[model samples]
Target: MSWIYLDNNATTKMASEVLDAMLPFLQESYGNASSVQHRIGREANQAVALAREQIAQKLHVKESEIFFNSGATEGINTVLRGIAHAYARKGKHIITCQTEHKAVLSTCAQLERTGVEITYLPVNKTGEIALQMLRDSIRPDTILVCIMAANNESGIIHPISAIAEICQEKDVLFFCDATQLVGKQEIDLQRIPIDILTFSAHKFHGPTGVGVLYVRRKRKPIQIPPLISGGQQENGFRGGTLNVAPIVGCGKALIMTNLHPEIEQYRDELEKQIKLQIPEIMIHGEHAQRLSNTSFIAFRHIKAAEIMTALPHIALSSGSACTSGLLDPSHVLKAMAVSDDDAFASVRFSLSKFTTKAEVEETINDLAKAVSRLRSSSPAWQLFKDGLIS
Candidate 1:
């Protein structure tokens, strides 16, 4: 059986082009990027510089403004630590949404121990934060506002532009976690007044172990304390020897895959087919703008994990990878006011450029079969069959 992968949001298979680009660095040019005395070290440094340039170009920011970290988690930690430590005097209060990744939510939770106050803004039924709620939450002591550009579970795109405008009016620094949005959607930093942005390369078919954080240069002199204190690196914000190979691979992957249009086309076709086959399935974020390559659907009376286990030839997820093992419903869905039944029955299907229409059709057919089988045994369906009064 040919296994189809629909869990692009969890992590993507490393692109062949990305692996090819990193082969030299991994095998031949293995050296510390900070070293200047050896040829290998110089080559690694050069590779790191080039990757920074590529990421900067993508974000429409200066190369100096972009910093490489281990991944989105690390990047987010750095941002939280930096703002909490450097701007502690400015304010001890931060605001974020309840649906943010654990990386962001947990970081804020940790900050609370150090006298930082945090308010988790609520999302609407569509899993989106209202701009007015953000405006209402801003206080004189509000130092920063953090929100994800796209949700990992529902693939819902948040109104970062409107939030940015609100932040600007309040003179509050805004940090956006764009891990799921960076390469999947078009990002123009110039048009959006975001103070900080974070993304991981693996989300875009690049290798893991590399992520980028963009800090707006024009922001008020906010000092961010280092997460890893060491020799001068990442402009002293993050201190550690850079991983040159993965960074090089990440840059190449972004340039190669993100520029291709076929990925978008594939996603459109998948959405169309699934809707045609399963009209009763409720699509999360259907009413709002979302990432083109992602879809979240809940099959009534079918357990998501049951469907996943039954389709062993397919790789898919219920929600975020970080929360995969937990039997509880996704916090994202809960924040969107989704009922327990819908949350447990939802599955996320994310497509990449490599996902073929054949695979999509096969997936749809398999899903229909799985849902039918599960529903036949479901207690809810049995109750409906008994002709119980509505």
Candidate 2:
């Protein structure tokens, strides 16, 4: 009765290396980063600096460009609010997609209350926004365009590079929520013209309550008002005391994931096996480039929640963890024009570097049996059996 955990997207198991990195900070090195006089404060500040450097090294950006936040949700809110307040004179218009995380969408809605106009670009059937549509969405007053690098539910990767180019040509600031893609994919900030990028360390093997936001140094400094006004932490962009322990752990986890690159292949094999074993399952966002570790599958004639209950030996999700308990279909699926039936039956399987071939095999076997049982008892199957094919 060994349990398999396949919900990396929801959260990851903290890596041992990360835990080791944080141990000192939690015990012997417990000191406020903002303090100046004490040796403890100096040591804590040094650790924070090193963590910043490590995060910057992975993103290929300068140390000064990275800022730590509570998580991706905060990072997103900071950018949206910062941009709206800072660039209100430039334009009241903002552009994003319907598939964006609730963090981004909700922040945009909040901005709307303050008079900022928002345009949610529609995605194609493949769960990707058209480049031309993004290009057309930009107006003279468009201040920013926020789009996620990889969808949290469907695992679809957006055309960020193209979107960056469109923003660059139009001089519109580009913000990317890379929570699902960072550590799982290569993000060369030097090569890409991204103004702002957000990542949650927990998405990888890092500890929770740690996130990174990369602001392009070369881009013009947008006067983003502070979200939390207090001490001069995070260059005054984000205030209050920094969480040094989790930030250090996040840095260590990121470094470890980067060192071991073969996890991508493991994820690919898992997806291949699941597809082969259950060919009838409709794979959402199949036509687009997606995160290697994620697979969103819909078991037709079977409820996703029921399948989840039946497969207690494995841990997975129906969609985004934040929105899982709700009965509504994933906004990402709905944006891609997925039918209500397919959306309701969908399940998200996100693997990790620690996942093994044996585990994947076991998952496929269990899922196949579960789907078969559910389908056997399905009213849709009975209707089809009675010659009501339509």
Candidate 3:
């Protein structure tokens, strides 16, 4: 069986070079970074410092701005909850989009229980939030505006810079969940003025459980309380014995992937071929600026689960890994106003720099065969063909 992986948005395989970079740190150089007096600890601290600089360089931010954490979930909590507590005296309201990842949405939910007001901005059919609506949502008491740089499911990019401009004018803190956008898109902290950002290493080709939060040090000077308590690590922001291997792997992965060229060509070709082979399938986020490696599709009357179950060789998903197991369709597609039936019919196929054209062609053939076989047996599909379904 030929196995094809098109689920890079969920996670990616760690590159060989990244693994090589981490091996030494995991074994010979293992030491508590907080212990600067010992040589081993000094070397570990140096490795951690280099990782921070590497991540910061990729984002075009200062080294001090990047804080290593567990992953985007913890980063999201650290920023949202941290800000809610830090700025409670000033305001209690926060604004975010409805289609945000569970990390952001759940954190906001927790804040709401504590009397913090949260406004979830809705999106249009194309999964892009309106800049005007965001401006209107701003209140005098709004403490933070949380939005992602790119959506995990559709890969559609939000107007983050525009959002930043709105927050700046309103004097509210802005935090961007850049988990999907970090390696796929270039983020210039010097130009855009984004106050904070979160990204995970596994989204690219790095080890999991390690991520970075980019916080502007000079201009905005965000000084939220530490999310955890222990001896000073991650510059006193996060307190844990550093996972040196994964952090070093993350740095190596970022540096390697940034130099790699765009994978948009393969993605575009896959969607084109899929459309030609399987008629009446709708692809979402076609008009918006999206990540180069994502293609989200909906077969008119065939459920995505049926197609997924029929094809075992290819690796893909119907939505975000966090919500895929739930009974309902993706909240992201629902937020875009896609019908429940159509939402269930949708699937997200994400590519990586390593995806080959041959694999894409094979996936197209498999999808076409699966869709044809399912539609032949589907009474609902037959009714839709006869104009019985609207």
CA-lDDT, candidates in order? 0.86, 0.87, 0.90
lDDT, candidate 1, residue 364?
80
Off by over 4 Å in 3: 259-262
lDDT of 1 by residue, 155-245 (tens): 8888899999999989999999999988777799989999999899999989988988888887356567777898898888788888889
Best model per TM-score: 3
Off by over 4 Å in 2: 259-266, 387-390
The ten-residue window of minimal lDDT in model 2 covers: 258-267
Model 3 global lDDT (CA atoms, 0 to 1): 0.90
Ranking 1 against 3 by lDDT, winner = 3
What are the C-alpha RMSDs, in order, of all predicted structures?
1.8, 1.6, 1.3
Give the TM-score (vs. native) of candidate 3.
0.97
Better of 1 and 3 by TM-score: 3
lDDT of 1 at 92: 92
Off by over 4 Å in 1: 259-272, 387-390
Report the CA-based lDDT of candidate 1 relative to the real structure: 0.86
Residue 95 in model 2: shift from native, Å? 0.5
Best by lDDT: 3
Give per-residue CA lDDT, model 3, range 1-390, as digits (tens).
599999999999888999999998889999877788999999989999999888888778889888899899999999999999999998999999999999999889999999999999999999999999999999989989999999999999998889999898988889999999888777788889889899999999999999988888755467688889886787788898999989999998898866344478888888888878888888998889998899999998989999999998899899999988899889999999999998999989999988988898889888899999999999999998899996
Model 2 agreement with the true structure over 1-390: per-residue lDDT tens digits: 679999999999998888989999999989998885898898899999999999899888999999999999998888899889888888899999999999889889988999999999999988988888888889999999999999988899998888898899998889999999888888888888899999999998898998998888763576667777887899887888899999999888887765344556766676677777765578887768988888888887678998999999999899999887788888888888888888988999988888887888788888888888888899985785678853
